[model samples]
Target: MKLPIHPIMEQSFAVIDREIGEHKFTSGEYAIVQRVIHTTADFEFAQLIKFSPGVIETAIAALQNKTPIITDVGMVRQGIANLVAQTFNNPIIVAVEEAPVALPGKTRTETGLLSCWRKFPEAIFVFGNAPTALLAFCEVLKNTSVKPAFAIGAPVGFISVVESKHALAKTSIPQIRVDGRKGGSPVAAAILNALIVLSC
Candidate 1:
């Protein structure tokens, strides 16, 4: 079922469509781009977002299958919770909150993300606020058989943001990433929300 949209949001989408004329996005890709733009009101996301080959279909299938959803932070979980509940109702695990404390050599999010990986290696992993978590995840992908159903690497910041995205790109996993330091919880949530809508 299609979710209800407020009139204001409807008008905003119309404006975005009119202004963002002539793009090469496929229908599924454009839906994600439009939602990200709608969430941030920044057209730059249209250029920053990247998708791996056949990722959308794979991600949508994962969602429809009720694959668990794991997020590096609570904000990203909160942003997509309602839609998730309305649709697949997949379990949402917040990485940072799951960790008892920061590990000796890892951030709390990273530690928690690794912990989640051990149990739900096939979960949909989303990193919206911690590049360290994304980096850790990529490291796991490199060294192990933990292939996520879908990965979203959109952590926003200057420190390791670019490096994290680059690391994710090197992986063969199905994924969506925001290049550079242009992504955050909102963008990450928007991308997942778009995928949820497509799955419906």
Candidate 2:
């Protein structure tokens, strides 16, 4: 299935290409970076975004295999829902929505994310907003033998954002991460949408 690009968006992409000339990213990685820049209109993502070795291929395989997708917030799930439906139609789970209440020491999103992890350890986990959730997920990954198919750590905040990303980076799990505190649902969605396009 081919995705249609509006004329305005096509022009925007052209502008992005002109402005981001001579990049180090591979073709697939560049596609993800371009989409993230398009979504946020921020060229800095080109530098902030980092991918683990072979992660693009691994992510594509997971999507094609119809792995479930767990997002830290509803916004991230909403952002990627349409493209996901058009592509693999993998089950999209919103962590905050799934957990009825926060656990004793955890935030609602963290608790929900943990619950989702227990149910779908091999799912594609995307953290676009809650650093607490990402941190909790990282801890779970440390203790468990089960690992997610892939992870996207792009939570945006000051509190624990950088730490969460660092925790994810330390793990052996394949991942795409934004190194600093400049990421959100839109960037996470753009990365997934780019992967969907690449899978096609």
Candidate 3:
């Protein structure tokens, strides 16, 4: 089947390539990033053309049922949180490398990294961290009963991005990603936005 590339995906690929070209990343890493973008875009296109509204409605409904949305990065999680709140009334939980604390004159404290997982029994977890952290998350999922429909840990950096993709390669879950050296909120947000759009 011929796959259509979303405009956003194309743009993301270009962005990643341009960024990688100027960075110290290895050629293999660059190729891997390209592969990830191609695969993710192709998959999303297939869903949009094949399932169309069904998939989107299901995801929306899942959120309406108060399914937990888990994420590692604060910024990306913030975007996901907003999208979830806007699209559904589900509870959202963010998993971070550190936990937040509420202490006088203290900006933040890591209450506990793993503690966040307790908020949701079975929720979709989105991660954007280094290879080690990504693998750790995946391992935890493997050792547990959490089954995710859509998940991603594409870090968008040299070793970390490569590591994130590698860790996910072992799983069969659908994922969204962008190619670049440094993945930030924009990349994560754009991915979620695309999912929402295509899901419709």
Any runs in candidate 2 off by more than 4 Å, and if so which? none
**Model 2, poorest ten-residue lDDT window?**
1-10
Compute each candidate's TM-score over C-alphas. 0.98, 0.98, 0.55
- Per-residue lDDT of model 2, residues 46-131, tens digit only: 99999999999999999999999999998888899998888889999999998898999889999999899889999999999999
Stretches of candidate 3 off by over 4 Å are 1-61, 97-113, 129-131, 178-182
Report how far residue 85 has shifted in candidate 3, in Å: 2.7
Which portions of model 1 miss their true places by more than 4 Å? none
- Who wins the lDDT comparison? 1
Q: How does candidate 1 score on lDDT?
A: 0.95
Q: Which residue pairs show backbone clashes in model 2?
A: none
- Residue pairs of candidate 1 with colliding backbone atoms: none
Compute the lDDT of residue 79 as modeled in candidate 2: 91
Question: For residues 83-151, what per-residue lDDT tens digits would candidate 3 score against the true structure?
Answer: 555555455565553455533432121222245555553565555544444555555666766656455
Tens digit of lDDT per residue, candidate 1, span 1-200? 88888899889999999999999999999999999999999999989999999999999999999999999999999999999999999999999998989999999999999999998999999989999999999998888875789899999999999999999999999999999899999999999999999999
lDDT agreement with native, every candidate: 0.95, 0.93, 0.50
